[model samples]
Target: MEVFVEPQEGSPFCIRIGCSDTVLEIKAKIEKHRGIPVYRQTLVFDNETLDDELDVEGCNILDGSRVWLIVAPEPPQSAKIELCVGTLPSVMRLPIEVQVNDPVKRLREVVRSLEDVSLERVKLYADGTELEDGRRICDYELQDNSSVDVRIKPPKFMVMVLPWKADLKVAVEVKQLDKVKVLRKELEKLQPSLELDLPSEGYFFIHNQSGMDEDKSFQWHGVEMGDTIEVFRGTISR
Candidate 1:
């Protein structure tokens, strides 16, 4: 039977070995075939990333199974979620709503600091309630009906000075696991919204590169108040 493998971009051929070959042997061979080593190349079976150091002894293989070796982007799933940024943020309070496709996360509450230049923070809450001083969004899950408020705090000096002049809002969106997986591709075409005026303060259209919202890209050209949203079939080259 013929086996299908996900070919890395620009690679000539995919490495195919017998069922008896261990993952180690496969890696060694792939390194020989390609310029990269087994350790460097990420191996994925059915979209699940495989650990390179682990032995292939317990990894049962079948005849038609496919293993792809690609120069993958960093942690594909997390990037998938954050790439939806500039769009509305999902709610992430505790006792969160559960969904079948909810990306399983160890997130709880976030006391965001709009106070600093670098948005990076350490991971605070792992189980839900506890807080790690400087953590990242990757650590948290945005649950349905849960509002993730990025509280903006003012900068502090050496002494205790009251903080003021910081404007922030509790930006929120509903999170449903099942809803996310369905947004894996781009929309063939977007539906035009009713002739409505998108206020400069309330709205700016996000690019529908991932087909998540099925909304088309917003063009600033000729767009004015009381104009209708134009829907088109947007395509990506790469």
Candidate 2:
């Protein structure tokens, strides 16, 4: 019978085994193909972990069945570390459990995906020094419970002149630390020259942009520098 085995962190493949093949036998096949030792291999099916001595027949593992394989993680040479992710606008703190051997780029990818921030904007720092993506977590020599700050670079804010008499729009270089109210104030000063009226209560919103709360900074909105903020009249709706 052919069985499908998927690794926890690597590629998945199919292997052929007889009905009487033991779990250890399956581990041996995986070890041959993936180089993970049989002793380190763990197999689970239907949410139940299978014992090493269990055979395919006893486990009731049929052909075309899928098995989840988790190879034991490498021991940490140093102490286990915790990563704290801080993203702008919301100033969210995400605590992540990580091993020393994990790649720094992997953590960056996680933050980038979670915050919806661009790869260039995602910055990881340990101590006062910036952490490079190509390095490993161990390279930082971070102690247990050490906080890693995830800062985002400021995206450019494009203020689209609403009631726009012209096709052109004005672009503003804004920092992630800058608030939406400040952005609106800047627009109020600039819009007069374009015959655009930005009322004292005027606010900015980007259509289809998630988390466009005017009270929050651009970083919180996951907005890119080139993205436009639609001009809205009156106060911002909650």
Candidate 3:
């Protein structure tokens, strides 16, 4: 008689076997057809998991009967490690369990899942060094109970714009990914009354007392919240 094996993820397939065939024998036939290991395959009939030692007839499995096949995922090769993740300046730390071989990117994903934050904006650090996504946890020599820092990247932040000749300072809001050119435009829009010709007057932006690249983003220049961006009456050649 033929029994239908319906996998959790894919279409069902037929497996021809005798009624006296044991569940283990049926699983062997499935492995031959599906290439799924017998140990990883769980067969369910009539909402009950079938025992490997029981015969198909004893389990009341007849021809055209549908048997649900659940394939288990591969087990982790390495032992699980516990790490404490805490946000900056926050005393509360959350314990996260992960495989030692798991990548730093996976750690960030775990944090994002538990916290109310986006995965792309999540940053993880260990031992004063920022973790790279492609590198594994073992690469950082992170041991069990090691503390990891989680910082959420802010979408928008404020920056102080200081004019070179004038003592007046204007606060402008900008995104972390905004380029220096965008910042200049934002400044112009915020104070339209000011007679500032950033483009025509050859005006440029400065950060940390150094001229900033107009094409570079605020994140590239490491501009933080309330950081001063000095405006000078000059143009950058490059």
User: How well does candidate 1 match the true structure in TM-score terms?
Assistant: 0.25
State the lDDT of candidate 3 residue by residue for 61-142, as single tens digits.
Answer: 9899999999976445677889999998797898899897777899898898887788888999887788877556765667
Model 2's TM-score against the true structure: 0.34
Residue-level lDDT tens digits of model 1 in 148-198: 333322222111111112132111121222232222211111112222222
User: Could you say which candidate leads in TM-score?
Assistant: 3
Q: Model 2: per-residue lDDT, tens digit, 116-146?
A: 9788888988766787664567656665667
**lDDT comparing candidate 3 with the true structure:** 0.84
Model 1: weakest 10-residue lDDT segment is 157-166
By lDDT, the candidates rank as: 3, 2, 1
Backbone clash pairs for candidate 3 read: none
Clashes of 1: 10
Q: After superposition, how far is residue 19 of candidate 3 from its true place, in Å?
A: 71
Listed in order, each prediction's TM-score against the native is: 0.25, 0.34, 0.38
Query: How big is the positional error of residue 187 in model 3, measured in Å on the Cα after superposition?
Result: 13
Model 1: residue 33 alpha-carbon error in angstroms: 1.2
User: Each model's C-alpha lDDT?
Assistant: 0.36, 0.72, 0.84
